[model samples]
Target chain A: MIDSRYKEMAEVGLAIRIKGLKKVYRLGQIGGTTLQEELKRRWEIWRGRDDPNTKIGQTARLTGETFMALNGINLEVRQGEALGIIGKNGAGKSTLLKILCQITAPTEGEIDINGRIASMLEVGIGFNGEMTGRENIYLSGAILGMTKAEIDRKMQDIIDFSEVEEFIDTPVKRYSSGMFVKLAFSVSAHLDSEILIMDEVLAVGDMDFQKKCLNKMREAANVQGRTVLYVSHNMNTIRRLCDRCLVLDEGKIIFDGDVDQAIALYMGIEDHLKTEYHFTEESRPYGRFSHKLSIERTVIEGVCDDPRIGQSYNNPSFGYGGYCLPKDSRQLLSNYGTIPEKIIRAVVESNDTRKKYIIDKIMRLVRMAEQAGQNSVVGIYRLSMKSGSDNSRESASLSVLRGLIDRGCTVLIYEPSLGGLCPVEGGVLVAEAEEFKSRAGIIAANRYDPCLEDVKERVFTRDFFMRD
Target chain B: MTRNTYYLDKNVHFKHISAERKWIDLRLGEVWRYRDLILLFTRRSFALTYKQTILGPIWLFLNPFLTSIMYSLVFGRIAGISTDGVPMLLFYLCSNAIWNYSSSCVTSNAHTFTSNSGLFGKVYFPRLTVPLSQVLAFVIRFSIQMSMVLVILIWYWAHGQIHPHIWALLVIPLSLVQLGLMGMGVGIIISSMTTKYRDLSILVGFGMQLWMYGTPVVYPLSQLPDGWIRSLSLLNPVTMPVELFRYAVLGTGTLQPVSLVWSWGFTLLALFLGIIVFNHVEKTFLDTV
Candidate 1:
């Protein structure tokens, strides 16, 4: 027979237990689009087909579709364990942390938590620009579900740790970005929660502050008997703070155990990637598409072995501009939740402003056609980056396409590769070239081709409009 | 520690998180627990909105003052509309005092989801606290504006242009509550939909303007002679409060028991439906947004 007290002691040591945890999302099916698409997707879902706009490779196991962000993850965290999670971009690391924080609900799963969790997913979770720093301390502390009395108790410690006590009365917006981060860090650091979750937040501030923060986190887990979960690309922090570690790839937990072993695996996985290329023979033309390499360009006369070439994929999995220069730069532009850097946030805002500028141009053209009391449809020439290719479902153009769709614009697709069939379940596919040309008020294409005759399709379409 | 009744229950589970797909999960207890957070949000709203402005709370009073005076001039003088045998300025101000509170409640609560998506995305707390704070935050602005109505009401009462009923004291607060319920209910329902169909945000501004015309803001319910239009006006959740508030303070407006029943019924129904929609949306809105 088992002793009851020992069983109780073991159960008490367990801080969190997750079983078969799953979080599924339809790829690029963010549902703030027009009502027509929303209802159409729902109708398809009701009829037992997958959600129409989801990417092809994602399995549609449930009624809708499944791009499982966290796929059936089972993890047991003991009390006071400092666990480091390392993963490549889009590897479900942040998603798991978000679910643990209960910021978002999982699609399916059971998560049992032993105590309160204080998470610093971003440095300042709720800092109002107009409010002074002293007020923001109360505001942010309250937002973390801390009582006013609790914040009042730790007020001096937080103010001192941030090292900006002189400007504590000034509004946070006036503080420099680094000072803002330090002030925000201090408030979250003093939370006194049973579980502490930090995600790449220590990459900023001067070295002294970073070192101080690292020591605080280590103290929280080791001395304070609080469970800590840290996710970072910086392996050094993991080595210094974590005793256990986890490595996630895609959506599943690929590795878990000793911290050093996880770091080696994470670094080794990146180093093992092979630089190989396969390209079309016609793409080599006088080095016009020089930036895009054709396989035979330069093996450089006995400098290296012949490059892997002339092999086609079994099926199309990627399209034009899949990855851009300074790889992960484009990925960083698209992924918002992971990039917590305040500077990156400004870049994201500028990217949004650029998209907005483009969207305004599209709207202006469509409205000009509508001035005479007629409904005119805007045409999207192709979603694929290259003209002939078909599998750029998640292309850069999709953001602009989605933006137009959001503004209640009627979009007709003219991708010949789709063969005028239903490329998207409810999307209109213009099969007849003459009809496509006649109906479109303005056409928007990502890349300029001889077929377009102008850099912007809307400008080309307008010139065509003037001629007719 | 004594509060932990389950401490000795062998399976002392503290928290459980899963895909909660229930139609109704108000979590009122959780909202109650985070009541301090709600006040803090309200304090931030008070501190932030008034900052960097020369005249702080004065603008709160001035904004409503100008709007009500404009309504009185447009409807009372320009359109030659009657104000139920009371001073046109007094009637409009009285109606506005009640009307603005409820309408502001609806407008503010409608934005609860979209405006706070930043805070909502990163942290965990009862999301209801944000809307409740909005509901509380506007009360400061409302009270300052409501004082303007009070001062004007005294002038009319002293001049013997209006009779002040004892029921003025009782019905005023009751009407405020009813209007708050109706507005918050309708607002949250719209809030839930705004995450997906952003058209609702645009619709809300124009829709509230039209809804004001439906209610007896500019003209009294008594102006529309006894018929289906009057009955429809009675059924409008806002009409009862506007008319009753006028009758209470100025002592000149329509009074019907049936209209009272209809108004309360609609208010309660909107509030009930609002809670269910809001509770469900709080969990699932991030997926769409």
Candidate 2:
């Protein structure tokens, strides 16, 4: 609940007051987590038995493993104040913003918000591909809960600010990425909302546009007297825009006060917390891979120690696949077909070669199993598109499975989501863990699970870095 | 800086968000507040669905026209089923025009969660606006198709081949309300449910197909032998609307006033329960979906 001090400060012009705010997400299974163990833990608690996952006199809740994304946060924001929230990755920065914006519900708390709220969690919230840019402006404004009169009144100003007057009637799908973000930010900036919740929205577009957005946001908070809650990794933006700051670490507020001191404390924690080791050129494990660059980039991109642009990580797999990765890469390749491009073409082709590699591995396993007098039924376990999610629409495992089946290999699927019939043609459906383990001579799991411990020797997986 | 006390005054509106513990949270007033959004969504559905097509909304007419032609060929000619004094083409066309309206409302909104999760996650609006707008738009589409059917019926009436009661006008409007609410209501409930149980989505696709067969869309209630099938079909909420509209225009199908009242009651009851379930699912569907 809100403490006495916060209540006192919030007595007059409280724009927001969050009390005992907590959000617990069911964390994705890494290695040993399972539904069976959760049930066992519940049964033990019923019988007054010692919990298997916890130490004596310690407490652990039943159900699958849960992560406290936001833990017992109590805050009060005054109207007309620009508050910056800074945090390392997975430090609940976005989760807190998401909650404040009402994009999600808190697991255990209540929040009181004053005035009409608008969020800029992404630059373009719902710009339909086929819709004209002008139509999307009205669409997004309506989506942001603005009245028709408000949109109609601000239409000219929004178009002028976006500088897309030449092609305003053209579909947004035809716009360059730069023009798209520009129009999107203008729509949000022109909104007459009293409270604005932004999550790294300033990271889009060029430097000039970023400066223009920062100025508009400053004008919104200062001249218009609107409350602003901004979350970003750019310390420079926080130092320039926010009058006050709050630093969150591991779901708890570590420092909350003046911007300079908060930045100092946040940076100090980032720099000193993680252990680092220096290695000579000769002392590295692999000659081809840089031992220092990966860790240095991870520290910089993740903790914001030296935040820059285009932060991404690499991991080898059967193919680079996810909900958007394959689709986006292929789309980019097609769009660049007239222009001479090498990397874009390679990005699309590399995935195919990786699938070929996986299929060859499965074929070798099948032949070996046939020589050993086994059925050689290759079982595929789970085909979630993205790690830490249940979506399986465009995952690498699905492509790999299709390749194996196309090559005339016996395929069996053991997805728990499906039963009675297999999802793919020419494959056996095996739902139960025990039955699948016994029937399939070779098991291919995209992500490793604890049930595969006994059959680990027979499992062929390309999950090099087992992190979701 | 000095602050204004009036900004945070207690009487001022404060949006309170919590773990919703209410049995019913329809938020109809909030949905009404977003009427402009509903209108825009309705306009978008009409504009985008048939964009870049050769015929555009003519496809709307072509769909029912072709379906009725097939029905007349199969059920009218081959099966030798009676149309109860109405011409075979007009009977099939009239039935399809009304039945297809409710069916479109359901099919379009059935995958609301799956199709619009990206939009839903990024913004906050009354989620009901999506389905409600589709229902409203289909009502307009249904009227256009109904007008075409009326033209055909007029040709029949001029020839002294058919007679329609004046009550058909009133019954048609009432039937639109009955069918729209029930279609959208059932659609959003299924959309909410299928977020967690995706298998339900697959079932809903075929379920609509099976539901049409169960109703008297292809065959008349009078055509069925007096047994469980006829009695079971009578209990179907769709039966009253379909039969009432047919009887109102053609004046020959089996129509029971008491059963019509029962259908209205069932529609209102289902619409209410569906709204509650949909509202409950809207808050947390992002997590499961």
Candidate 3:
């Protein structure tokens, strides 16, 4: 009857029909504090105060943002259809399956399902550890919403299928992770649900198990006439299991039609002629907990292998110079207390620095650069901490200035920090930040701040996110 | 599409679970649906306990016997606590077996979230069933242990070392109710709390150890020196079952009928609250845990 309905819909040009699908996760950990917050919010709503922040997307900048993982995705599925979803992680493939399974409630969405849904999200999820393999069978059955009697009927078959008959008496805790995963997977597959939602569950138990899982999926889809939504990182699984595809990038569907085309799109096989680096900070979005910042106009010079003007890392002469910000300066300071200024500067130096711990020893790099023999003036740039507006740094720009001065080359101050506190004792003041770039052969920055965007060729610094 | 093998009777009100009359009927239906799996779990629980042991199931009887002897000597002789004129060894063994059944269930149930987190993360099921099966398995073990106590009691009765009361007939159903209610109630409560703070799981082990002293397992209520100690001993829910058990079996102590009734009321209340909290906690436990 369901199949006939699907066929009828296809005859009238409807494959899958979805309307106004939305999912929202209320952020913040559920704890005692959350309980208090819930009470407060409920009391406010009861009193008709509106809480001021009750509106959707209104509390975006608070402790947690209300993220719309999926936004109004409407689609139709015909009698026989396979769809593949591709995205660079966090594109909401897993979320869609979870919603279908009703494992979690969507903040807003309506799903009309015509069949039972089975999910192979992970193995050993419905298992009882204290119970032996035999006892867990009953527990697992109840977990799958099957009656105890139903479990009794299926007991022999499940044991044989799992190939864990010998170890059935042993508690699951003693089982190796691999054996446990296999048995759990076997149980899930045996469950006779019509609609299957699998989320990267195949990447377990070794190569044999993986192949078996794929075969099982094929059997469920092709032989059983069951509809399946499978999510995986393996492109080959997508190519094999899926008939059509939907590509999701940054939480939005980028392409949806052909599986082959979707795979190609996912792999970045398409051609684009723009020579400039096409990057958007929002493009590489990680989860809410991780920081995502953008840095532009990084320049590295002074080394013999420095790149030609406007060249990328691919160029032969442009030896890729990447630097790490000293991650825990506070901890390092706490460990050593306050060391001499020279020692602190050397310890926190990024790769571009040529400094020795003691003043008696001269660095080979400085000697080499001096031997190159030009009236080379090195420009010193901004030195600051990680983010926000703060500048209590053991400044590396000062190191470059000092190093250049020690080597008998002209040094310049481009920083206002110098003017306010320790004004350049010996170096010339190139008053204009822009003018300093043209005058100096090398511009060394403690951080790749955005202000030096034009003279990117002469800039040498490591600032992955410009805010730092 | 294959012809449907599964069938639901129209007369069966599948959604009406609130009616106590229908509870067993609906549960039976679900039990029939999952019969094969429950058998699997029950068998698994039994077999796994004895899996790798050299003596295997023999340890089940030996565990309670050894514990009983230790408690009897420590509490019966040195402390001079009367076990209601019953053989101290037999009395402690009977009470210890029941307490073990209930306490094990509670401790295991407390760590339900932390221990089964891996499984819960992956699968869909009525999470209660895992703990339920554990309680059942513990019940089975308790049955075996009780048999040992029965054999010792019959021997002592024949030799005239102990007297048996007609109230002892009530012990069977009373023991079942006493153990089950306490286990289910305490188990659910601990399971709910342990999800958020693992401190409860750690505390349960030590708490159970100290709790034995408060119950009449090692000492009779009459052994209390005075008012506060006697009153405090009565407050422990376990005191009722132990005292009732001693009275029914040995017929040597005053059976405070009112206190016993109060204990029953408390046990039921605890069980009721436990179920409610467990149901609520199970819904959103995954998000927090």
Candidate 4:
């Protein structure tokens, strides 16, 4: 009864008018106060104030550090128009859907939606594992904001579509996870929602179901005149489904015109989008343990310090933090071992003695730290190898940690939450910031946390930008 | 159905996305809109818990009976946990049922995000309905458990073990509020964290076990020490619901005046924080999850 009243309250015959659509997410903490937290923190120095974001009972959390997932963006989709959001991971594609569905709020932007929205960001959300397949259909529908009457009306359609009617009354917990996904997706697709925002949900289920989802989305756009926004890494779907496209990178919209241009921008093929390789590991920190490592220097030695110069080379080792290199670099190094030493030297010399000079400089730092005679724990800020890649496979940090441990200094690793401690068969996980702080006599931080304010007095940090 | 939409024009070429309500009201409205979903969730929860078991729903009744009997053996006959002169079985049953309801609400709901991240990432609905339905399902189990408690009371009444009072009816709404705020609060808090750091989700499962021990489920609330432990017990919003349940059933309890106040205060605060954090998280949790 009330739903109809709400439906009636909406304006009639007004098309969607999206304008100045922006969504910015605080990457790390909840209560980030400003736009330039990382930059401001670098220049300003005030100590010992409590991070306002921390709750009373929550321990070891830092404050004032965050990253934006989506910057101020704008878009407009006509009723029944199908729009595609194309981006790589962390490109704010999903964040836009969340903002559209009212699942999350934009920190500094506005959008005017035309009608009710039902977003399928993933398959089988709002499903009850304990419930039977039949019950979950109703539950999922209700979760999609459908009424009981509507769910009942469409129940048979859902059952037939999912083909799980045989076990409809059986507990869903007994169903295979795949079966569960099918049933949940079928219910959402069948239910009536005005605006459908999908985020790679069709990737699940069997191929048959994927085809069905594609057909349904086409029907939703063409037959029902429903507006749709889809986010996916799949290039085929983006081409097939979108009439207009928006491409995002590093939280900003690089392209918003034709689907081809958007795809080209997302693929980094457009000249405008390819200004400089702006995505340095220096722009944003990676994952929970970004605090564990930092890059001290990059050296090409006898050659110039230029990656573009080395891009064409068969094999080259980018001088890293005294320990290890990236996997690709390792592959290149081993592959280079097969080449003539003269060619290797030639390749090194072409960069202006850059690689050797870098190695010499880094070795000097290692010796200087060892000679300082302080028993001071020299924290090897994570062996800075390359940028943009989180899977730092040939991590210099791994070697540095081993080296520090071999030297008998208490080495505390604070990187990605490891399943097991390195080298040592038995070692404690120093999870708490305070614990990590108090236990280490001299802290080596690749990145910094404001929570380590008290211990920063004894810490050695190399975080200039705080990006990975 | 009304053709009215917030902003739609047959002649216009496009649509925009916008959100209006504050985070709290938005979540609350979502919970309300998905009330039917909650019912479905509760029904599914009830069925699944008992699937393939011969006793099925009957165990709902049997669990409290067996528990009460065990408490009678240990507390009544062995260590002698005081029941304020109420029959130990009746006292234990009353407290146990309420605690069971409260704990189930917390435990099941606490994993709302981690358990349903697959669903959450793919769909848009009021996330609150998941926990809300859990409370309802626990209530259904409570109803079964209550019937058994009543049967024991009938026997005790015939033998004059205790007397029933009209205040017993307050258990219904009180249980609802206790379950609603407590489950929603803890559930949302846990859900927010589980999206990024999975350690809390693992610990929460075991924490529920320890938490039950802290709660006076097997014994009466009076047996614990008088200082911070007692005050700390009050901090668990479930403490009030369990104590009041016994007060209603036994007509005598150490149901602290402060316990009720504390429960209400904590429930509101936790619930407020939960909604805020959850709203903040739901936006980008998909990337993290």
Candidate 5:
């Protein structure tokens, strides 16, 4: 069967043939349905009962609402061709990539791909921080489907390309973030596969590194005759990397053909949507203070005495720092380069300023209490960035602690989540709630906890909304 | 244009590999091609198993040693469990080593799709490589522990406390393979189930502990009353290996021929079902995971 199919495909000279590809995802659950639920549904159907989830003429019945991530995507690529897939967020670009990589299956239709495919969807996958850089190189290489002998042959080249030979023996945890990306990209670039699929991996690393990656991709496609499927939000990169481009909008292919025209078509739709909103001075609700700053001030006013006293003022604790915000903000800043912008730069620096402001307020309160002849020990309520979470990475409380220490203030931390040990030096970790209350002259909290209601008079916080 | 025309003129044969909606596409050939990846994952997990610890690989032996000591104290001294005249240490150690290998394989494979979702999300290597590597890692650890068992068996043999059957050489390897398949099969099924309903993943820990009791790991199969209880224990696939391992090494065990055949049959069926579920889940697990 495969031989006959291959013979038919060979006549067409197509490197990849995808027909009527569709991927429908159930909103909440995995694997579509459970055995019990499926049996129940089947029983109901057998009894001639109407099933709410079934549509007429559709063979598959969904238990819940479903989103068609890729709807009838039909496309083909010739051998050694460079194809770019562009879409807005949720336009099914990632779903398409996942299908091509076979990481996830398409709910319907079929994709026939010729040649070995090496996908770098998110770089630095399978990197262990405890392992040395050299070991991680081999590990990541193998994960990308390179054999041990293949990695051995390219080890020197990978090390040289990443420029981490001096520190290759050091644990990856010790390598700088940039060096880590360099090593990861190097390993993937060295994969000798016939088809390469890359998705926004170049969005990381420095400009020079990105240029090098683009050049390597060019060499892989143009010089060595390899098919390339590139996905990126950057139109410039898309144009540079691909000869033909596909524009996807809401799971459907809107346009497919010349790279420039596809990009133009995408941009045209985006521009049309964007033109509806005008950010002129006349549109500013709060005169000169930009809408962002005004909103920040208003939120601060609701929570604190003044906007200058809290971290973000807008959100009580620092600005958003969950998985996406910090990295995306940095990426946005990098795209702006040296452009003289106030709000953009302030968004990055506001967290630090807020941390400093918190420190200043705590110090002032401590000094006032000391002058009034009270023991000026400041108690830190929690170390986590948000309530009911143990993750302290980029937590505003840590920054506050650092600021308090740098200014030489006596501080005690009360965090049950951190267990018995105090993470910071010079600050005792109070295990008991009563002991913490008695020792603290003033308490600092990112968000208000009801456990401190009895000591509310001594507590200092800017949590108005009381939400994460 | 010239390249396209030349390819058409040459009638170059192309391989069209399409994704199908079949319930049981084993894709065993694809798994075989990615054997190197499986090996690397095995090595990576082995290295990481004790990366940060000061004792390192020594802990591999220490684990079974400590477990056996605890069992000897509890079951031998306190509970007065019979070892059938074979040394209690050797009995527990042998059974524990085999039991640990099988249990670990199932428990670890149960999280195959959930735990490796990060790695699985980005690339395409045969999804089987992950569970296969996990099973291989268990085998490596089992081998290391087996050496310790061998030393104990030899010491007991020297003292004339036990007489191991010469057939042990064949039984040992055969039972290990049986245990590995049983574990892998159960694990893959659980792992596939866990992708959608996480209740199974949570239940696996308690379920494994209960499963250990159901198997004749601590007690000899002969000790059970010859009725429903014995018949039930005989039906358990794990009971065959425990009994077989004890029969091979200690030369005194209740080996029911019918039960042995049932165990092998169950292993094949479970493994077949596991592959089908795993293949079906691997295709679209990301949607839920």
Candidate 6:
């Protein structure tokens, strides 16, 4: 059966021939069941008892509830062809790549491949941080299926390509993130395999590196006569690199043929279904409060003016701060260079205004407590941006703490993940959780936890969402 | 057109890659082709492990030496376990060196799928290469630790404190290979099992500890009450190698013919089962793991 399939595939000059490729993944549990559960299920089946969990007419082969990641995918690729697979998240693009790489087997399929495959599904897959760049090149080369002699022959080329020759002997732990990706990509690009499979390797690094990678891939497919299977969300890169493309949706091939039409089909479906919006007065109220404030313009532009100064009590906190928003807003600002924009710039400034507003709020609370004749220690509950996380990077809580200290309030911090190790400079590290709760007159938290239930009355927060 | 034809004739080879349902597909040729990868993995592990350490490879020898000293103090003096007339240091060191090789091989290989899931999920090489490379790395470390045992043996031989057995030379190599294969087999099985049931991975550590006690590591097989317990210890694949090492060097261990056969049988069986499961798991483990 396989010999006949191979003969037919070879006659067509096909590099890859896949038929009826299906991958059904069992949800929730591993291996479908525990040993006891498996034995009991078998026993129950033997005794002619139907498992209530098993759907009627569902094949006995599917032991548990399954999701078909790739359902009956049939495709063929001509030799030296560059095939781009485009799909949204959970559309089985990665699952197809995983199967092609032979990292995971399809639930049912016959895949007749004509050449050695080198897949760069993830860059730096086995990079030891302690190993030097030179060592990592060989290790990653071997991992990508390059022989030792092959790596030795191409070592200089890889180093030159990555442009990190000076730091080749330095441990990769010391290398910048960009340098690491450069070295990883260089090794992968140097793999002398007959077929190359890649998944979004261009997503990392700068535009220059991305261009270099794309050029190298183009060389691999066009110059070297190697078959290439590329998966990416970047339609421009897809059009540039691929002659043929496959559009996948919910584990089935929705469109297959010209790259442009496939991308258009994918975009048309995605763009049309996306939630539409209009900037009317009614909808303007639903706009982010920071953007609304920027539109209101009570706070003057380019004046370091606090946007929160005259805001009504309904405005909950200044704006989102944690890890994502500030960075995203700044990135958005960078993208809008020379383009006229007001609200984009204001959203970035609103975070600073919010911190200053929080400082003012803490000062008022401290004064209120002092006037009522109580100790005025400000307890900062959780330095983490979110509850149950140790990440304090760009945390609004830390900024609030710093602001409170600048206003001359003794700050007590309660961060469980840090234990007794306080990261803040010149801040009191409260070792005991209960001691922190008892010492402070007012406790300020970015997000509320049920642990603060007893002191809920004393706690001050603008957490209206009750989520991260 | 001629050049293209020549290139196709030379490079093209059709393969039917599919979901295999068979119990075993021992692709030894594929493994052999990627022999360079095995060596590189071994080198990478060896180099990366001791890269930043000041002691470097010296720690390999120092680790077992310190472990044996502690074992001698506890088992020899404190607990008063007999080494069956062998010197306390030699017995402890011999068993420690051999046990370290076998146990580390199993422990490292058992985590083969879990620890290297990131790498395994990206590339395709013979999955056997990973556990095989781990076994080879452990062998290199074992050789270093073995040399230390040899140095102590020479010292003991010089003082006429211990007699050397010629048969030990033959038994030692055989036992070492047996121990390695046993470790590889058991490790492969655990690695495959843990890919699905992660709870098995945790149990493996505790199981190895209990397994050490069951084997004749600190105490000789002769020291155990000559009944079901002794016979049970003999049935353990690890016991044969530990006893054979002691019997070969010191010429003082309960080396029964039936037990040796049983040990060999168990090792081969475990290894056979391991390869079957490993071959089965490598194909689909990415999805489950």
TM-score against native, each model = 0.71, 0.70, 0.60, 0.59, 0.71, 0.72
Winner of 1 and 5 under lDDT: 5
Best by DockQ: 6
DockQ of each: 0.31, 0.24, 0.16, 0.21, 0.29, 0.37
* Order by TM-score, highest first: 6, 5, 1, 2, 3, 4
Q: List runs of model 6 lying over 4 Å from the truth.
A: A1-7, A28-63, A273-468, B1-10
What is the lDDT, from 0 to 100, of the residue A422 in candidate 3? 26
Candidate 2: tens digits of C-alpha lDDT, residues A196-262: 9998787555446777899999999999999999987656678778999999999999889999888
The true-versus-predicted C-alpha distance at residue B215 of model 4, in Å, is 6.6
Interface RMSD of each: 5.3, 6.6, 8.5, 8.0, 5.8, 5.3
Q: In candidate 6 chain B, where is summed lDDT lowest over 10 consecutive residues?
A: B1-10
- Candidate 6, residue A49: lDDT: 85
Best by TM-score: 6
Predicted structure 3, TM vs. truth = 0.60
Native-referenced Cα lDDT, model 5: 0.68
Which regions in candidate 3 have their CA more than 4 angstroms from the true location? A1-83, A110-112, A124-185, A202-215, A248-258, A268-468, B1-39, B224-235, B252-254
Candidate 2 chain A least-lDDT 10 residues: A338-347
Give the runs in model 1 whose Cα sits over 4 Å from its true position. A1-12, A30-32, A36-65, A273-468, B1-13
Residue B109 of candidate 1: its Cα lDDT? 89
| Model 4, span B225-284: residue lDDT tens | 888998888777777677677767767656677778887888888888887787667665
lDDT of 3 by residue, B66-122 (tens): 988888878888877777677889888877876787678777777776777666666
Indicate the residue-level lDDT of B2 in model 3.
10
Candidate 1 residues A1-468, lDDT tens each?
123432543566987788888998876456527666778778998999877855588554432445888998999999999999988888999999998888777888877677678989988888987888899999999888789999999999999999999999998899987788899999999997888888988655655687899999999999999999999876667888999999999889999999978866765454421222222222222322211212111111111121211112222432322112122221221121222111100001111223455455555544543452232332232333222233232233445455666677544323222221222212332122223344323332222221222221121122122121
Q: Relative to the unseen true structure, what is the Cα RMSD of model 6?
A: 14.0
Encode model 2's per-residue lDDT on B29-127: one tens digit a residue.
778888999999998888898988999999888888999999999999999889887898999998898888988888888889889998878777888
* Runs off by more than 4 Å, candidate 4: A1-18, A21-68, A87-90, A127-132, A163-184, A201-212, A232-239, A260-468, B1-27, B52-55, B166-244, B254-289
List the TM-score for candidate 1's chain B: 0.92
Docking class of 1: acceptable
Residue-wise C-alpha lDDT for candidate 1, range B1-289, written one tens digit per residue:
0001112344442566767566656677778878889899888888878788999878887777787789888888899898867988788777776788889999988988999888889998888887778777776667777787789889889999988686576877777778777888899999998888887898899999988888988899879978888878887878888888888888887888888898899889888899888877777678887
